[model samples]
Target: MVQTYTSPIRVYKTPFEFVMAAYEKRFPTCKMIPIFVGSEITSEITSEDKAVTVIERRCKLNVDAPYLLRKIAGVEFVYFIQKNTLDRRRRTLVIEAWNESFASRLVIRETCKYSVHPDNDDWTCFEQDAHLEIKSFFGFENAVEKLAIKQYMANIVKGKEVIDYYIQELIDEGVTHIPRFVPTGITEDSALDQSGIEDEITLSSLNHMALGATASSMTMDKRIHRDSLYKLDADYIHRCLGDLDPVEESRIVELKQWLQEHHKEKIPSDAHLLRFLRARGFNVEKGREMLCRSLIWRKQHQIDRLLKSWHPPDVLKTFFPGGWMDGYDDGGRPVFVLRLGNLDVKGVLRSIGVDGMLKLAITICEEGLVKCEEATRVQQRPVSYWACIFDLEGLSMRHLWRPGLKVLYRIIEVFEANYPETMGRVFLVRCPRVFPILWTLVSPFIDENTRKKFIIYGGEDHQQPEGGLTEYLDGKSIPKFLGGDAECGFPEGGIIPRSHYLPDDLAEMESGIDSISINSESLYQSVSLVKDSYHEVPVIVHDAGTVITYDFDVCKGDCIFTVLFTTSAVKIPSSTPPASPALQTSISVIHPDLKLKEVIRPIPCSDGSSEQGTHVADKAGTYILQWKGVDPTASTAVHSQFSFDFGLTSPPKCKVMYHYDILTQDEFRGSLSSVQSFSSLSMA
Candidate 1:
């Protein structure tokens, strides 16, 4: 198979003649590039006027192949045939070179061209294109392919420097410029009259001398110390985007210095720091503040551990659609494609609840970061972010449900705050009319910097003839659903059936508010209480012998907890709302003429921290777990303005921090067995 690479056009602000002089210095030997062993001019042809020179040469390269391959091939040096065509009249030089030593089993061909810049007479334009084919290489195709690409990429940087080095050499030697070739003699056949190098000559050179100076000859010496000559430090560039330029060197130094002085543990690498700087338009102070805050947030959230530890609940993983794509975008950023229109928004919320969905979102963002790190390793570049492509193919007004939108916006807000600059790009495709309405509602919440990265297309705008996704994505990586060649098998999107739901009790608990369960983040809830009123949560048990066990951590305030169970003879209040788990009025009002019992008193606390208890309901009834708060004046820690309560109108209030759970019947068998074991041990 053949591997080809075509570089983006590189501009050098130097004249063609000056660039040529530097190019010529790369032959035989150059310290900037030690791989080029030497070159021999096998043939040379010159025009009569010395205006053109065409040379054919055999260039030797010190191949950096594996030792085993070197031994197998039995060679230390590789040779290539280089053909050079220097057309002085046109101020252009084209070099074509092909490997000769490995022509049978492998082939390496490269073409390089240098011409006067179209818009600037004093500048030159250079481009390098290379192709490598390993027809059959002793089952070392992959290794050979990597070696070829590695060598080629290394030479690309070095080649530019070669010109720079020679330009500096000429500058230091006081040979500032080489005037364009011009014929002088009147006779066409005279050495001073004939046109040069238009017809033939093989130009062969393995590696260009120096990147910092190559082809950019005229400015070589000046660029040597200029901060913006290339990208961030070469090492940083090698680590993702070899082309990202942070604001300036001084700003980088300032930020790094600040981080070192003020925040040592959170100091970011130059490459990682660049993203934050870019997000804030390179304002060192603003970038530093954002970075510091992000570091704190990560530490507090334990985000480093989240990626490996946070897994979405099974119901959500299966029912809530949209997943990471198996492919990546053109720039090596992971591409996550989701068709929002096709997802069952209501169903998802009903299944996972707002908190579950939030967890899923956090997990997704965490996964993206993980993928970005992996890509950076694979591409040997800094790719700290991922690209997301949202396909609004089926988006409509139904998706704008008020509650779900609130959840989504809250999610967006969380992501915007916590994962700044995590989105490399967002491609909005097949947007429906409703999209704008939704966008208007949420766009204001999106970060301004993030808004700039959104690329939107209406209807089939992305598939139009104009520069579309194809401009940024490779053909094979494009999703076939988007009219590209690549096949995308993710999402498997559709409406999740109502039958997909778990039991109503389970669903209610998962959805929150309607059930006793609360998000782990809000495990300990606070209740404000008055001296006479009680905060009660009723547990309705249908069968006898049901077990109700609960646990709660007290974060603040104090209260006495007791179990209130109803008698079977008492009729449930007809006026009471069916979903009301508690009667705001005193329990006596509901069980007026019957038994209302307190099965357990205020439990003694082993430590003044939390409370746990278990109860067995031998008869069907309504069980109320109540927190009866007392006046703060009774507490040991005391400091207050009012020495006494005025009246019922301005009575002092109490508060409690608590959480509870129930395990019924068979579910508590393990608990019963453990209790039995403890009882037997105590007796022993």
Candidate 2:
């Protein structure tokens, strides 16, 4: 009967991801489980039997129990269960299985495959073996039909002989290509003690294998040796690969041929070699051509001599003079130095043969020649000269040394002090210091103070003013000085006039004064003169012709001065006349100070029967008028007096006219006229 088994499976896209996932799934749950994983095929019944045992022990399932099984090709599974017995023990289980025919067929259809061939093949035997391992591990049912696997297998068969030869060569070179399970003798001491040639040969062989050379011909023992060698000196092997001489014409040609032969194969292309050369700082194009030519003449006389006699010490000493081996000679063992000139150029040259040495020498010689030329040119050029003068008053002295005036001065001073007569003949003074000194002395001065003032003219000055000039210069008090009107004149008795007076005729004075004459009779009409008691003294009147002088004392004391004219019943005209009897009694007096005042007084008027001339007196002087009238009670009374200090002219006729015809003769006449009766007074 066909046996069936079930196991818990976890699937992932990559082997590494699968392993990690399986570990996480199995840890901490079941500890006692048998796990087996390898890339090999066995009978189906045997695989089923093993799966049943693992499930019964780890999943605690009966041997005969029915279960479902799921598997994905190229994937493995892990499971956990309990073991039988009174005290059941937990354990883990793992299994491998293949996918169904449909999925396997699909995988085979989608992949790429190739047929085996003897030449013009692709892929490596080692990669083919890895592919087989992956197929087995994943239980790939149709793995043989999968294109990737088929192509890999075909390349393995086709390149079988070439791969075998390569592996045998590596073994002869002391490199084991396939390792077995054994302790490798790769101690640090063994690697450190390796001879230079042995180290280089081992490194080169290992690099070839690491770069995907087939190792099918390597025996298990040889494989172990290869692995041991790498473990001992992996870094050295890596360094050798990087230092591969792109300009070693023979090696480059061989590599190129190999690449061309397997162009269709997945071997590294020419671009890869170019990248390798570039990483080593080799000029790829030049190195490639050089390497090809060198390879074609591999056995030439000069190359043979170079390989036999050339040593790293000789190269180092020639390229780098004194310091070549400074820090590199450790205990006389010549510890490898990876300095720029040593490891980079020298190492590449050693790998490439005699031509590389010649190229390196040429480069070093050219660089040295350039440096020597630069040094010689620098020595030949003239040195620059500079001098300075300090503590000088004028800017010329300070700037003189800047324009070579100092050197010129030195020449002149030396000539003058040593050979004055020779200096005149040589004209050295004119040629040197004398002309320069004259130029400096005569150059127009640029006052720094003026320049700075012009620059900041609008800026405020914060410095305090000195001396008594402070008050005059202070901007805040300038207005006070400008607006003052102080009396200013020359000193007394000084030669200069105390005051400069212009001649009166040349003064062109304003016409503001006049003179006039009047008779005493006409003076009565002149109120100004009448009010002044006909004073004949020359009195000045303002332009208004009003007698500005009057005697208030006489008017108030009731002094009567005469008028030469006869009294008329006709009224004297004036701008304003009395409007009431009380007002008629009112009198105005001009005080000595030119201020006017009203006085009250009693004056007698003529009786109507009395002739108008009855009141006239023999007094011929101008008289001042005084009047008195009763108060509102008709019992109490008040008096008014008026006096004008008039000129000897008839009082300028009163401009106003008053009418006396409207009153009856009895009413119009009274001892004391009513102030209202003057309302009709006329003015001439």
Candidate 3:
């Protein structure tokens, strides 16, 4: 296989003629490069007016390889043929080199060019391309390829340093500039037109120097002009995108070019493309696929306008305990603090529902992107990711509420899919023992690379002098609650008041879960119940000893949930039909004469909690799961007709989202704790 490498354009703060002088200094032999043994000119040519020159040379270099391989090759050095073409009139130089010693066994070709910068004529630009193919190397092909890549990368970095050293040396020796070439019989205006430069005509040789020519500055400039979209700067990559290896750099260029060609209307920023590439381990195909899907999602959701158009609801503003810190971390990344211990997860879920919470989380991510761009400008460096500190001091089992966790899992999926590599670090301070249980449940859903970024601390470990927040954040920026002086303005969240919760009807509408029908987009179904009236769906079991599992959340009001089993077929009412055939095989309506054997006694359920349980069938029969809405103020069930007497105005309604699954005894694997009352099924 042939391996190729292409480097970003490197700019030098010097005129083309002055840069050419520095290039000439590297010929014959130079001690700066130890492997560069020597070079002898094999051919040379010059134009009549000294405006163009061409030279060919045979160069020798010691192979930087293992001793065993060197012994096997039985040679002290290798030879390469190099050709240089200089056109002073155009102010450009091209160098081509290829290995001569291993012509049959190995093929190495390199091309480099130096020309005037398009944006700034006073500055010079250099670019390089190379290809290496090792057909055979005595069964050490892989080792040889690795060594070649390592050596090539090292040399590429050193090449710029060598030029800078020579340029400085010339400056120290008081040689500031070299005049551009003039063709024979050319007037002054024509010469200026041909070269696009004004130079003193006196200094034709290196010995004679012209002090009037503008002196080139030695300091490096790291910024690239926005207009030069086709070219990438090496310094800009180093400063803004972090250090990338040669192959990774190639991948970025390739992917960027692909996007420009295919999606020219809107190309993502380099940092965004890089995030996807990193997420996919630099595999261009996988990265492209992931990025394309995310782009479509963004368009479909109108994510670009989210920062300006979307605002957090009043509930999130008042009860959500997460916010971006006013200050940045030591690495200049924006810090976001999520006070999980102070968060009332169950309350928030009950108040807003899953769809509302998802929208809020996405809004936060969009805000993070904006802050990241601002930080990059303010800090004058790359700030593509943000840091998060999760304060888990008061975390408890209530946070493990199944419904709330479902919302949490959904948020993680969206973040991983659309916002990869946006999390630079995660600090989980003051984590309690129960935190691991939570982590175990959610960590599997997180990407391995992302999970590696988590930094957890228990008790007072985060306040310790070593391996603490201080190591990553400034002392003055640490929150006061974490043993620091800074005041945290994020909400100190508590349980939300039930009065603030939206009505059951409004909540269902906002969540897009129509209680009247079975939604194919969602696995769970929702239903609304009025006071005294009960809802029943019968499950037909064909196999005995099958396990039936049910999970549900009461989104509004209060209710009692019970399970019933009877060998007799339950009568169906024409007024209400089963929503879907999968879970609700048959339906039953509330009737005065109806009586069924109760398997699981009525268990009270209310807003802000999730209930889950499993029951094993002793014999094949029809089992019904029933929900009866009860008055919030009453201990005894009220008859359906007089339910409004307890309430002054209107009848109260309860809303629930539920799901059920049946598995054979041998295939049942339950995640939650089993019900201890499974053996206490009573027939009444």
Best by TM-score: 3
User: For residues 216-243, could you state the per-residue lDDT of candidate 1 as single tens digits?
Assistant: 4434434443423222333344444446
Error of 2 at 403 (Å): 44
Off by over 4 Å in 3: 68-76, 104-106, 134-139, 185-190, 196-227, 245-247, 346-355, 497-550, 555-558, 561-602, 606-609, 612-656, 659-684
Better of 2 and 3 by lDDT: 3
Q: What is the Cα-based lDDT of residue 248 in candidate 3?
A: 76
Which scores greater on TM-score, model 1 or model 3? Answer: 3
lDDT of 3: 0.78
**Candidate 2 overall lDDT versus native:** 0.25
Please, what are the lDDT tens digits per residue for candidate 3 over residues 258-289?
Answer: 77657745788898999999999988889999
Report the poorest 10 consecutive residues by lDDT, candidate 2.
Answer: 421-430
Per-residue lDDT over 326-435 for candidate 2, one digit per residue giving the tens place of the 0 to 100 score: 11111111111111111222122223322333433333322322332333244442111101101111222223221122223332332222111110000011011122
Model 3 Cα shift for residue 97 (angstroms): 2.2
Task: Please give the lDDT score at residue 115 for candidate 3.
Answer: 91
